[model samples]
Every structure is written in structure tokens, then in C-alpha cells.
Target: MIISEGSLVLFFFNSDKKWLIRIENEKKLHTHLGIIDAGSTIGLEYGSHILTNKDKKIFLLPPNTYDFVMKSQRTTQIVYPKDYGYIAARTGLRNGSKVLEIGTGSAALSTFLASIVMPEGHVYTFDVNEDFMSIAKKNLEKSSMDPYVTQGIYDPEKIGQIRDVDLVVIDLGDPWNYLDIIYPSMKSGASVVCICPTMNQLENLATHFFHGGFIDSDCVETFIRKIEAREGKTRPSMRMIGHTTYLGFARKVLK
Candidate 1:
């Protein structure tokens, strides 16, 4: 595979050695042998081996977009890829679809959203903290989907200006306060997705979604378990990432 400059790829050796690597400008990737300048490998073909300063060979391979975002430096907890996939699927996000995302946090989900809603679509992301926004801004800039994001440092509730948006994704601590604001902005049949970690929050939000005329208020969660396989022995891994958060989705209906 031909690796793009910003594509996330893996370096491997001996058929069993692997290291997840993100391609960046002028980076010096350190290995057991020595440092390999990322600049020299930018336009190189995937699966090609590059020799380090000490002459150790390393293989290169590209990683999926999800893996790239997960490995990014995070200033805040990220929405797990499990939740992100579901959100993307249920929201019907695609090129030319406008999206509103509250509580930008580390911009992890924002980056993912931008990747799908590209070309003409734009994601209006809101965050209160400049520090978090700065980190998210840097992270998105390093990805291929940075152009689709627009940052707002104002309170989402106070702004309340999005109209006819295709989707709304809320990751704030208290999404209930913005229900009324979001309801009017969504196009008929548009979807809204919320991420909350606690059951109590879900219960409260369910009530508001129902009264606000949102249909199909469903709650879902994802659990990912990896497996270890070698020769004839294959079994579930000893550890797994579980219960990252609960996802609540609802559709807008005409009153």
C-alpha cells in the first residue's frame, strides 16, 4: 500500500515485531537500532524496509483511521471507537452533511466525524476551555480530516444557532439543558446521539427526549474483547476494555 504523509502506519520486523507509527513531518522515530527520520520515509512505499542508523531493518504498514485516533495524545478521555462507529452509523453522517458537536473535549470524536463528513460538510464543535481546544486543534491538524472542522469557544446553549443540521452529538456532562435548543435546529428525521457514562444521566435524558418529541430513544453500550491465538490455542484475552460509556440515540419528529 502507498502510505500518505499523515496516514498512520505500523513498523514491523522478523514477522512478529510491530510498532504503531504515525507519520509526521521531520520526526525522528527511535528504534532498537537507532533513529529513523520520518521525513525520509514519507513518500516511501508501504511494506518496504528502511535501515536505521545502526542498520536494523523495519517494515512499514498503514493502520486504520480508528487506530490512528485512539493512539493520538489525549488531553481528555476519548469516546471509545466502539461508540464512535455506532454514532457514525446511526447518525448517517457522510459527505455534505452538517453536524453539531458539543463539548469538544479532546476533539477525538470531532476528528472521526470530520473524516466521514468531508468535501462539503463541516463540523461545528463547541468547547469552553481554550487549552482543550488547543490540543484538539493540534491533533486534528495532524490528521487528514482537519479541514472539515470549525471551532467555537462559546457555550453551545448560548449560541443555539445551528439550523437544519443533519446530526447533533452531545458529549457534555449535562446534555439535558440543550435539548430544547437542539430540537429546533435538527432537520425532520435527523438523528441526535448523546454519550453519558452513568445510568442516572440516561434516565433523566430519556425523559427530556420523550417530551421533546424525539422518537426511538434507545440506550446502548459496547464491550470489546480481544482474543489471543497461537498455533492450536485460541482464547479470549485476559483483559479487555469494557463499559466506556452509554450511547443514547433519538430521531427528530414533526410535532
Candidate 2:
């Protein structure tokens, strides 16, 4: 597809050097390779190539959800993709599924979930920090997922208007405490996921899950090992993603 003006551009120089920029007229990109005018990409198609000022081949590519998540601006650490993939699968999140997310940290998971439910469904995310919500707004905007996401402050009254959600993802410090707050928003049999950093949180959550009108509760940690593959040498990467967080899953049931 032709890269339109104001479109997000993925200028890839190589495996290690790449950037995501919006193609704006006369915007100059300064990089180690060379300076490339963002205007050069306006009429070019993705998968097309342009030359940097120093004659480096810069590949025009498309950006995906992973790109948005990795490039998002944030003050807090995000729930990495490895953990999010499992959370999404366990929640059965899909197109047209309504989601209520508490604690929109970096909007990494929010953006990912929005991508899956866009053009049909929506994600409502809230956080107490204005700074964090500001960062999340930009992240979702950059990915063009902002339209499908509703972001707000962590006002209980503000969130009270949202209800009948298909999935609820709580990324708060004391997610167990918010179970009562989110419980009313979730449909019966809908999934609720909690992103916990410590086992103590999970243990606390398990107790709440048992007494809080939720069933089929489970907790898991996801690990992703990268493999270094070559023509002859194939081995695991020296550095890989370790335990990021534990995902707690449960379904809402009648009291």
C-alpha cells in the first residue's frame, strides 16, 4: 500500500537500527546512518526502499502492535508481550469483546487488546496517575488504536458508568481489592485477569477468588526463550525474557 502523508512509517535500516515516525512533509530524520526526510516516504509504498543521506538503504515497512508496545513512552514498566499473549488467550479476547482494564500503565497491554477488538469492540482503561494516562493516550494514538480505547482517571464514579464487559484486566498494585469494583462490571462467566508481580499477590488473589464469587481460578507465568538460528549454529539466546509477571485468571460466577 502507498504510504500516505501523516501515516506512521517504519523506517528500518537493519536489525538493530530502525525507527517509527509519522511521515510528515519536510520532517528530517537524523540517525546514525544518515538524515532522511520524512517527506520522502509520503508517496512510497510500504516494502519500498529509500536511500539515506549517506547512501544507506532504509527500508519502508509497516508497524504492528509489537512495534507500538515496544516504542510506547512510559514511566512504569509494561507487561511484556509474552505475558500478554497468554492473558489474551486465557481471556478469549477477540473482535467485539468488551474489555474493562484497570491501571493503564504504559498502554502496552491496552494497545494489544485494542488491536484485537478494534472496529467492533472497545477497551475502557483507567489509572490514578494523570502522567501515566497521558503516556497511554500517546501510545494508543501512535498505534491508531486510541479510537477503540476509552481512557480515564481512576475515579470510582467515573468507572461506575461502564458495565457488561466481556473481559476485565486489573493491573493494579492491590488487584484483589478491586475485585469487588470490577465484579459488577463483568458479565457472568466473563474472564478477569490480574497482572501480579509477586507470588504474595497471587496468594492473596487466590483467597479473594475463592470467596469473591469467582471460579475456575488459575495463575501462570510466561517465559519466552529466543533461539539463535543460523545455517549451522542454532542455539538459545544468551539473554532472553525471564519471569515478567504472574497472570491470574478466573471467571465471574453467581454468589
Which structure among the candidates has the greatest lDDT?
2
Q: Compose the digit string of candidate 1's lDDT tens values, residues 131-182.
A: 8988888778866667889888856554477788999988887887777878
Quote the positional error of residue 30 for candidate 1 in Å: 3.5
Range of the 10 consecutive residues with the lowest summed lDDT in candidate 2: 154-163
CA lDDT for candidate 1: 0.81
Residue-level lDDT tens digits of model 2 in 121-236: 99999998888877788888889999999998887776777888999989988999999888888899999999899999999999999999999999888888888888799999
Runs of candidate 1 with Cα error greater than 4 angstroms are 1-27, 31-43, 51-57, 156-159
lDDT for 248 in candidate 2 is: 92
Clashing pairs in 1: none
TM-score of each model, paired residue for residue:
0.85, 0.94
Model 2: number of backbone collisions: 0
Off by over 4 Å in 2: none
RMSD of each: 3.2, 1.5
RMSD of 2: 1.5
CA-lDDT, candidates in order: 0.81, 0.89
